[model samples]
Target: MMSSPSPTTAQASSTAVAKRIARTARLALEKKFAVVTAQIDRELESAEDVVIDCFYNADSRTSQLNKDDEYVHLLKLRSRQPFSLVKSIVLKDGEYEGHVALIMKQAFPFAFMKLNMEIRKHVYEYLFESEEKVIRIKTKTGGQKLPYAPGYNTYNRAAILAVSSEVRLEALPVMYDRKFCFESTSILMHFLLQICDGRIYLTDLNVESYVGSTARTSFYLLANCKRLRRIFFKHISSNEQPKTAIKNFWNDAQPWLTAASAGQGDPTAALKLLVFDRTAFHFRVKDPNSKSTSVKAWQLADHLVFVKGLKDKLMDARKV
Candidate 1:
């Protein structure tokens, strides 16, 4: 008859089981993270901030709010890779409150940037903050002083040149030899719901944002949109690790290499604004013969410009 195992033997067996479980868990996590990173990279096929960080916080900014009650400014990543940086704005009672911009100078996108601001000590607080210190805004405390340092813009974030303008999406050149796979979301869920919910119309939505970095990637993706067709040069890069390297890589993508070559100095200037007309795009219900159609509205009418651009670039990408 086989003898019963000793207590030590039983303990050893349990430990072995635990080790196996841990190894399996690690493998599973590696696979999941790899999938997530890949999906993000594919989405941002043209973003300079190729690093990926979920920023899993409830608030985009740590803790700040302005008058407009816009507690959080959403930096929706149209592309999969993490953003090169994040530009945040704080408001109070529909008035200008404060701002911040996060950037990783040493490395590229694998780094994270969180620009948060609070309306405490509006003057000196602005004069000196960020590591690089790249802000110049007029404040109530005084003039010529950095009113909203570490912030995107003082008076209005929507006016920031990057976010406010119609710009071109540069093509990624420095791709890695080995590519990884990700199984996460390609397009941000928020923007998807915005277009699908009808809160923002599909035909009139703006592909660009007037905040941190330009929504050049959005325009690139939407360029191939159904209504207003477009084309772009898309590239894929390896999806791995701490993300700082990817961040840096994205900061230097070029458009000149691609035929669209939207000026060297202004990489995104060639956004090629199709100037979609709200009245022009007509929408109908599910039925082909249904007259249950509607025109666009002020905010809702601009969505078409956003999603359609994606459909366009996707269509004729090879030609680009």
Candidate 2:
């Protein structure tokens, strides 16, 4: 019973409805795209942080990119830089990926290997050598329990050794030429173990010696230092039987002495100086079981005799 609508009006209404549906679809697609873009941005930021941390915080100079596949992909996409470039890259505040690319592009392009051997040696020495008279080696994680001299300067140039393998190989010898002073025999042993073959280049060393397996092991390792020129041993007294302490001293010392005496050249040819503390031959040990109120020191006569014997042995070894 109702009148039919005009064709033009119906066509117009249909067109309006179609336009509305299209607008809604467009808005929904836009919202979806916005969400995806934001997620991608967050991922990129996270990946950058990971890359920066790896570049700076890694314990060794090795690639740690396998930790995260996504970040690894991100890094690969960002840049195909060499490990040395990656290592030498340092970022400042507010800098990001674009800046890193710019830096990589602008950094010195001359190959280090292209330099003359003498020039390369000079560069290595400049970087690895410390102005400090003595470099004090400390444990990676420990309290500073040992007393250090106040006036003397100490340095830590070990970071250069971690730059790259090529750099390490060339710089190690220069680094080891320094006068290293350790707080204790344990620390000296640890240092020697850490350096591995680098010990062969060590020329000078100073250490406080305690009567223990650690000291013995340290001396045993010292035999590997075929180029050693001088060693200063500071005797540290501990609670043990006098005879046991003296025997431990001899046991710890015998290996290095025998090696030096048996050198390819003159006896004691490898060592320019062999120093010992003034009280090196003397020992004061307390018997835990003894109720004696006073501790007995080694007899001065026996101490002098031991000192003379050590001196005579050293003199005999030093004769050309």
TM-score of 2: 0.52
Q: How many clashes in candidate 1?
A: 61
- Candidate 1 at 22: error in angstroms? 0.9
Against the reference, the lDDT scores of all candidates come to: 0.33, 0.64
Which ten contiguous residues of candidate 1 have the minimum total lDDT? 168-177
What residue runs in model 2 are displaced by over 4 Å at the alpha carbon?
Answer: 1-77, 80-108, 140-166, 236-246, 267-272, 281-304, 307-320
* Model 1 global lDDT (CA atoms, 0 to 1): 0.33
Cα deviation at 46, candidate 1, in Å, is: 11
How close is each model in CA RMSD to the real structure? 28.6, 20.4
| Candidate 2: pairs in clash | none
lDDT of 1 by residue, 1-320 (tens): 99999999999999999999999999999998766655433221323544443332233335457688866533324324333444444544444345333442233332111322233223223322333332222223444322222253334422212322221011011010011111111222233322332222123232211221323344333332333222222222222121332232233222211223223243233244233333322332344587454432323423444334433443344355
